[model samples]
Target: MTSAIPNRIRAYLGWCPMTGAAQHPAPDQPAGAKTGDLADSGGSVTGRADRFMHLTIAVVVLSYVVAILILPFLPEVIPVHWNLQGKADGFAASIPGAFGLPVIITLVTLLFILLPKFDSRYAGFALAKDIYAIILFATTGMLLVMEVIFLLIAAGYDLPVITIIPVLIGFLFIILGSLMPYIHRNTTMGIRLPWTMKSDDIWKKTHEHGGPLFMAGGILTVIGSLVSGIWAMALMLVIIIGVTIYISVWSYRYAKTAG
Candidate 1:
């Protein structure tokens, strides 16, 4: 039974392995071609998404390598948390703690790649394959930055870890904002709400209008995170909250009429 697990997983993934990339056959291929065949086929969406999966795997592998190299140099008790002023406010003595983030990010990468396969509207993934690839790249790339920051702090770099995290998060939001308009309807991710999920047209419209607002908010977040004093992160939090509410209301209003 154990031996069949991988096969089952591969079967479940439908040979695309990257966010439902090959669920349907490519046009140029013979109608009789298998799903896995598209992964190797040039100029196809499946081929592009599969390449993204490969890069994501490489990032995860590099994270592990970084953790291994830095573990030896980290202090016995390193700061795990930082204060508003970027001072170390918490500590832990686990040397193996370094590997924790690598493991987490590995799982996160998998989640980004695999979760879309099971999306209630699973077919949506194929239409938004590029969207998935870009989002995955942004997500793993941000986590990689966080991973590096953690290690550097553990090695006593006296870095502004707290201040930097929000900026990174802001950039991630910016990336998501840019991609929102391109996203097809999917329940597993995006600005999913009861209203937006009702229709594909509603989803597209909401994203088209909301995408710019989100980008504006992300810009504010990045700016707010950079400003010193008066709790920069708090300002970012407020901006994020305000932007979300605005976007939600817009989507809801549009969806109400759309329905």
Candidate 2:
């Protein structure tokens, strides 16, 4: 999944995040619906759940309000970056530092908003629309929490960001793992490995295998962060890298053995 296609065409007709620029709708689409919209025939909960997605803008505004409140108290230069040991190393001028997260969050929210429209499996993306909304809102909430904490730090509150961040992230992964099994493969999100690209059965099995592993890793990350903040962050990175490699290999092997 990558920047392999011109975004304009990708948004209109849609293209998988990886593989190639060209794509076509599923051949078996229902007479009056797209491939995944078969569920919409049964009175989908997606519409009710979609309110969470709309709530993201409200969360974004809260971050901006927080930044405005905290700006007057922040020093002329604030620590915008931190080292593994939680030491503030990177610095930025006050105004930019104060509003940093709002700008970043606004851009990220917009990008997420556009990603689904660009997804080649546009219909499949809606298969688990409830999960997607929760995932999106939860992720945005996590970032909002970070923005609040960072602003507090900039306002001279003493906090261990290195430790706090890992715990929060670990929980997020757990939530993702629990919900991941329900998501169908989509080019713009989730696992898009070559083997997963092969078939729906492979994609389904891969996520089923991966869900528990993701939760396990999250548990380890929480434990690691609590026991040793700095080393835990290092271990967290290693776990992420290691898990991705392991999952890719696992999908490949499973794909090979499947009939």
Candidate 3:
């Protein structure tokens, strides 16, 4: 019996390790390895320095928007908040009101439009433009939420049952739109499960399927947002996370089998 057991273990160990997944163009390289369009273009900046600049700009714009949205609700020049965790936070509460969300959005949107023109390779993908629109819409909804919260605090307004509908719709559009660029590309964004990143085909297929799934889920999220209240947001989050995981695993297995 011991000899038989040893033979069985040996057989198992000898099984093929590759598992039949389709062999990628190069396993060691990241997905979208070619980005060759970027290398030859004078208009594009591929250095880490350029990337940092872009990220810094994005953060600044986001901060400016937050300030614009929060200032109008402040009773004084200073925005103050006391948290249950024993922290006091204070800022210029009137900043958001002074800027007005619409004005902030417009300025940010202009930046998005102009930033893409700076790069030749990225000019084609135009992610900045899309992100700009998504951020604007999202900011609008967030401003509305802020208004609701303020009303609840100062006016005892429960936030009309119907006013929330538009906010929900706006939120869905924002979420779905935010995923678009990532849905279109395969590098360092939007649900980077290890297996999916390991195989290029898996990344492509998963995103191809996941893009639509997430969009649909986002639409449902809008519906849920207006109908079921906060719980709806929870459900939408679950669906997005769950579908992303499922597709990642499926794509990995499928690639392995096809290869």
Best by TM-score: 2
Q: What is candidate 1's lDDT per residue for 72-187, written digit by digit as tens? A: 89878777666666666877774657887788888998788678777887556565565576578678878888989988978878666656888888888887777777666776
Residues 6-113, model 3: lDDT tens digits: 566434322111221111112223433443323211212133224334444454466455555555554555323323221335344454434444454456545654
- Using lDDT as the yardstick, the better of models 2 and 3 is 2
Worst 10 residues of 2 by lDDT: 13-22
How high a TM-score does candidate 1 get? 0.79
| Residue-pair clashes, model 3 | 11
Q: Estimate each model's TM-score.
A: 0.79, 0.82, 0.44
Question: Cα deviation in Å at residue 158, candidate 1?
Answer: 1.9
Q: How many residue pairs clash in each candidate at the backbone level?
A: 0, 0, 11
lDDT of each: 0.71, 0.72, 0.45
Superposed model 3: Cα runs more than 4 Å off:
1-187
| Candidate 1: stretches off by over 4 Å | 1-42, 83-87
TM-score of decoy 3: 0.44
Q: Candidate 2 clash total?
A: 0
lDDT digits (tens) for residues 1-259 of candidate 2: 3565555443432222122111222323322344333333222335424456667788889989989888899999998888877888999998999888888888888888788888877666765555666677778888889988888888889988988888888888887777666667777667888778668888888888887788888888888889885776787777777777887799889999995
TM-score (C-alpha, index-matched) for candidate 2: 0.82
